[model samples]
Each structure stands twice: as structure tokens, then as C-alpha cells.
Target: MDTGRRAGEPLVRHTVSPHLTRLLIDAGTAAGLDRGQVMRLPGFDTLSVDPVRIPTATIMRTWEAVGGALMEVGGVARVMELWRPGTLGVWDYLFTAAGTLTDALRASGLHFAVIADPVDAIAVTRDGAGVTVSWDGPYRDHPSYPLIAEFVPSMFQTVASSGAGRPLTPVQVRLPHRAPLSHAALCELYGTRNVEFEAGAPSITFTEADAATPLPQSDPALAAILNDHARITVETARPVVSWLDRFHLALETAVGDGPPELARVAHRLAMGPRTLQRRLNEAGTSWREELERLRQRRVDQYLRETSLSVESIAARVGYSDPRALRRAIHRWYGHSPRTVRQNPD
Candidate 1:
């Protein structure tokens, strides 16, 4: 029985393990971005070095900020340049330790959510002469979806090639999103000239021979240990579904579209405004407090992560008046936006 495929309620919110975010941070730093400065930026400053779960929105925002920075310095392709084995910790080892590429791909389907998110986003299937690994889920709505879509397939290819102990090119690579302005770097990285975009989903297919290649690092004992750790992590880290989580999701969904309106959010959640307020109060928060917190985080993110002017950021965060935004920043952090941007930590 494939217990990993058991049906369950969907998560009200999604989370990513910290190492993925660390990968982006490391890649940004390798591309010449300041580690301290990037880490001090709003969405990243709070992340722990330990393997705690990070909110998907936080990771998304950080990727957007860092990916943009990397593009200016050396192109986002630098992330692949900085990649190496063991970057994913137990997850990476699980693949290399598997008896064969086939086994590694199976383990990926089983244990991926232990390190990534949208629990069942990865699907491993046999296609006559090829094996396909698909990544598609509720990730489309994310602001960082395009980067995530591109990153996942490229990262998977890297990991699979490392496990196979050879440079194994995909049979084909398909992405659901529109092609980027310049996907030549992506084509070169994926070892293909034309990567299909606007596909049904994000997937990579490998020839059956490549899928069966024995990894040089295969050790059943190590594989067992890593599998145990992954299973335990997946079981214990399953996110709890609750109204509070739902509320947070609603708020995130409205980010950048505008300030999250109370009535609209409540409607989305299938509850009256009063009921949503009551639920928040029960959860030891309120709409105003939550909105303010969201605003403050966005303000910090923009101030420190990018070169966007204050007036532009003010409008982005739904602050029509720059002075009002300044006052709010002062109230939130006891410092001007400039000071916060300069000394984010």
C-alpha cells in the first residue's frame, strides 16, 4: 500500500522546509549578494538555521527578492552553479543512497514533502520507455510561482544526475507557465535547447535506462536511516489545519493585489465579517492586528530587499500617503524606513 497517497484534507496553508530557503540565500550570497544584508531583510531575518518549517509565502517572497538580485549580478542561472550534492541534507543523501535511479525517484515521490511542500505535489509515474516526475499543485497562485516552476525541474535534474553518477539529460522538460524573457540559460542548464512552456504541468521525463542507473553512493543502510528520518519528519511536521491558518492564507492571497479587505476575506472564507473577527479573536488575534503585521512585513521586505523607492513601496503596500507609511514604520519599529533598511536586523 502506498500510504503516501492516502487521501486527506488539504492544508489550509503551505510551508517549505528551511533548507530550500537557505539554498536561495546561499546562491544569492555566492552571486555576490551580502549574506547579512539578505538575511536581515524582512522575510528571511526570522528564519532559523535549524530545519524548522518556513511559511511558503515567506520563501516565495525571499526567492522573488533574491532571484531578482541574482539576475542583476550574474543571472539566476548562478543558483545551478552554486548547487552541489548534500545541499538538501538528508533528502539529497536519500537519493544518492538509493539502490538505483528508479528507487531514488520512488523515494523522491515518498519523501519530497518532508523537505518541500504541497505534500503530494510530486508524482512519479512510468511512461512506457520513460519515467515522468510531475510537480503541479496550488502553487500557481504564488507570486514566486514562475521561479519556483523553473527551479524545481532544474534542481531535480541536478539531483538525479548526481545520483546517477552521470550527466543524464531529461527526455523532455515541460512547464505550465509562460516562457521567461530569456530561457536560453534554462535550456543550457536542462541540457536541452527547447523547453516546452505552457504545458499541462511541470514535469521531467527520463529514459528508462537512465532511471535504472545504479548510483555509486548506494548504501542500503544509509538509505534506510534517511528514509526513517524522512518518514518521521513528514508525520510530525504535518501542518495543522485551522481557521487561523485559513485566515492567514486568505491574507496572503490578497497581498500586492491590495490591502486585504475584511469583508472580502471573510467572504472567501465562507463566513461573515463578524464571524471572521470572532474567530480571529478566539485565535488571540484580530483583523487589524493581522493586516498591520502583514503590512509591516511587506514594508520591511521592500525597504531592505530591493531598490524600490519609498513612495512606490508605500503604494504597493496600500499606503496612499508616504508620510502615513513613514509614521506606521516608525510606530512598528521605532525607526525610520531608511534606518530599518540600512540596519534590518
Candidate 2:
């Protein structure tokens, strides 16, 4: 049998287990919206045939719709409230079956690609006495990114705390987005109030001792079986490139030495400058827009997370003129660089 995927197939950049999509839809229903209303929201029309995977882009669009629908009802808090552990299918099971939080996190990290794509964007590292997990990617531009940003760490807390049989607070938490309207919900979820906004990326850190604590539900026999299944799943569904993610990767590399030039990015992507521009246009964005957004995020991070001078930050982000950077800061944030740095809230 020819088991290879068909030719001329499009690459799905990212995907989630169908259960995650169902969770999003269910959140909308729990918020008093009819099921039809959620399904009618953009990107729910395509049904998943694989039973395990659903396009994450579809979920992203649906998230925006659900957030808008729930804006008046309860917002992201309601979604988090409705979310329950063990609803994530195999991904969740891998956690409970593991011997300790550290083992579970490592296993989850290894099999994450089975549930989502662009697997390299996530990093799991261990310091002397702490383990840190972080996700840094082009996903910040998506409207639903902030919602997912907050939701993910909270979910991690819930799962880890429950599995460990004790509350394990993160040593630190960092988010790239601004703080939400209600900190109460977040404080309650993480079991800690030490959350920093406008960070370079989304990350959570826990002490190594906490991570090594054994879980009561650990079942090595079942874990071995699930590990085999996860390995098979990841091997079967290889990571596929998304053009948007590729562009982001190229842009990030290009911006290291200096400003990101369209020609340089195009060459990096093995496409002509014109073709890249056309692709961006078709995606409802342009090179200038993405460049500006990237610069804004970098500038914001530098201002909030560093003690760098405005001139230094401007040069770092490719602005030759410090005054120009100041004007951009005012335009984007309605404040001066100094003000933004001091009062990120």
C-alpha cells in the first residue's frame, strides 16, 4: 500500500487535538450561546476526518469569535472556568500516567508535536534547581493569542497541581501581552500572583524539587503503552511548514544584524521579493505592516523588560533615529518611551 500523503497537498502549519476545538465550542455554549451560534462562527464549517487532529487556524478564528461573543457574558475567564482536566484526550492522559511532574512535562514536550505543529518553537529546559518551559513564536499577532497565553499556563497549573497531589506554584510566569482586565481570575488559577506582562515570550518556571515530586496516579505499565502510542503519532504526522510561520522565522533571523529587508526575507524563503509581497497581500497583510508589528513588540519588550536607553532600543530595533522611535512609541501606545517603560500597566 502506498501510505504516503497525496501529492499537491497543502501544509497545515499548526493543529490541535479535536477535543481542544470541542472545548472552545463548549465554552461558548457554557457562556449561554447556542451550539449553532458557535458552529456558525467562522472556520467551524470544515469537519475533521482524522478524529485526532483539527486545524489550529480554524480554532484560532473560532477563538476570536467566541471571545467576542463572550465579551459581554464573561470573557476568557468563563472559558478557563469551563475547561476541565482530562478533556485533552491522549495529551492529558500522558500527564496522569507519568511518575512525576518532571517526567510528565518532558513526555508532554516530546509528544507536543502530535497535538500541534511548529514543535521547535517550544523549549523545555532545566536549570540547576528549576525547570522552565517557554513558547516563543509568531502566534502573538493572532487576536486569540492573549486568550490562549493566559489559558495555557492556567491549564498547566491545574493539571500539575492535581497530578502532584499538592499545589505547585511557579517560581515565575511571563507573558508577552498586556495584563487582562481582571487579575483575580489569573491569580486564582496559577495559585500565585507573580505574573509579569510584556515579557519577551510566554513561559513558566518551577523549582526542580517540585517538578520531581511523584504523582499518586502514576502507572508505569499504562505509561509505557501511551508513550509508544505518542511516539507513533508524532512519527506518523511529521511537522509541516506554514508559510506564515516561515516568514516569521525568516524575519526574526533577518532582524538580528539590522532591519529586515523584503529582498533578504524573500531570498531566505527561496522566493522572489514580488512573490513574497503577493503572498503577504493574499494573507491580508504586507511586509511593512508585519515589520512594524515586529518592531513594536520588540520595542515594547525592550522598554518594559530592560533598562536600555531609548536610543539603544531604537538602534536595536533598526531605527536609525531615536526621535523616530519615540514618535512610533507615542503613536502605538499613546505614551512616551519613558512613560511606557515605567508604567507598563
Specify the highest-TM-score model's number: 1
Q: Poorest 10 consecutive residues of model 1 by lDDT?
A: 1-10
Per-residue error for 306 in candidate 1, Å, reads: 17
What's the TM for model 2?
0.62
For model 1, name the residue pairs that clash. none
For model 2, the local distance difference test gives 0.69
Q: Which candidate should be chosen as best, given lDDT against the real structure?
A: 1
**Tens digit of lDDT per residue, candidate 2, span 191-299?**
6788888886777888888887778899999999987886665445533336775786577557655666899999989999999999999999999998897788667
lDDT per residue, candidate 1, 13-129, as tens digits? 376667778878888777777788777654464466444555666566567567656766655567766777777767777778899887887887777776676443677888675
Q: Each candidate's TM vs. the true structure?
A: 0.70, 0.62
Off by over 4 Å in 2: 1-12, 41-43, 46-52, 70-75, 180-182, 234-345
Which residue runs of candidate 1 sit more than 4 Å off their true CA positions?
1-3, 6-13, 32-34, 41-46, 73-75, 237-248, 254-345
Residue pairs in clash, model 2: none
